[model samples]
Target: MDDSNENVLTGSASQSLLIKPDISTPLIDSKRIDLQTLINKFHNQLGDKNWLKYQSIFSSFILGKLSRNEFENEITKIINSNLLINFHNQFILSNLANSVRINPSPNSHISGFGFNNNNLFNMNNSNKKKKNLNNYKFNNQYEVLKTNIMSLPVKERRRIKNIKRDSGKSNLLSANSSLYITNPQNNKSSSQPREVITGNAVTWSQDIMTGFQTLLASESYELPDKDTLNYRMTGIMREHGLFGSLDENSINVMSMAIESHLKTIIEETIDLVRYRKSKYDEN
Candidate 1:
């Protein structure tokens, strides 16, 4: 009877150990699980489609007390699923991958959109308008500059003629005064005749005038046409020391120097023209 009771006690203890308890195990911390947060993050990063199925699987893993290995297997299953077959889905996936690698800061305040920087968009648009304005100003200034440069040769000829005439008169005065010297030499009187000096003076003046005229007549300088005006303006601006230290690609530097001047002049002229037109209309 003692052996039998000992055996029964051992058997009861073994049976008790074999039977599963009905009591619930304490769940993992809500913070540690974080399945909802992970789902939201995945949705934000990967869009709705890819995150949809994955979110369900993640939820099941968290709620069902699935092992880590099982959770990872579910993730693999979702990844291997053939859900994203459309071009739009592919584009979204590509953008999602890029976002995951370089997560942009959320800009939910301004545009009320999830991930767009409306400020940056506005800035880009403003910059584009500025660029177009600069280009328009450049084109107008280039046209005016071509007209001015092309007129230079004719204008320079008149200037050179005036300068030569003035110089010739000064030379004639000097030659006439110097012709009569204090010393007598070789049968010629110290007081030389006015005719001889006057003749030599006329000859020298004629030679200089002829040379100046020839230079004015030369067509070596070819001014830029309308098609090539912008290219020529770039060269002229560089030569004028406007953009001293900046790189050649610095459009802002070029525009600051060239466009500002042009815009001011053009606006003033336009205002004047409009004023004149309004007065004429009133008349």
Candidate 2:
């Protein structure tokens, strides 16, 4: 959103307006936004006239300090005493109801917030059945993480290099021409050749596998299929510049390391299932 440091390009007689750069820009400041941060943003945007009344209760519910039943009871009292007459108030009430309806079944309807047989939430969640917290299923989590990593958009670093190179060439053009252009950001003093530094896949693989192990250990889940996991892992390894460019030898090294760790995880998960069953028999 900050455009103050962008480079500008101009043509001779047509140098009337500033042209925006073609470089990719991030939509948000960071990848993650916490609940409190979101609440502050909403408060600033929507103001506090009606917000002040329910901010405390809403914050508690959102932060998991208040249970669903308690939140519904508190909100109902507010709705009864202060009727939501306008569309804005009704919309706010509906949103509040929606925030707590995390796992509505297909036939479930939105109630207790003036919504008349609303199946919107139900329809949205119909495809996604509620997952039991204690069910030991590691396959789904692994697949989700794999999908996220694979779907990550690759930034065209080459395009930036080309743009900087072309911008430098403008200085060689005839100054007497009717049109002229220059790039202050790509001036001769700062026009140094950038080195393509590849990241260490061996070290990165260690950390990546460790993190995945931690995730699986903490969660109860079924073990993922080895062949499917191997297939996805192979694709990830073959992915160019993911962990940076690795030579044939280095590629084999990293692949072996990750595969070895994955094998250990599969063994541990089987042991865990056996342990859980033994404990249940004793109980």
State which candidate has the highest lDDT. 1
TM-score of 2: 0.18
Write the residue-wise lDDT of candidate 1 on 30-79 in tens digits.
11111222333434554544444443453444334455556555555434
Reference-based lDDT, residue 273, model 1: 100
Which pairs of residues collide in model 1? none
Error of 2 at 266 (Å): 1.0
Clashes of each: 0, 10
C-alpha lDDT (0 to 100) for residue 247 of candidate 1: 47
TM-score of each: 0.15, 0.18
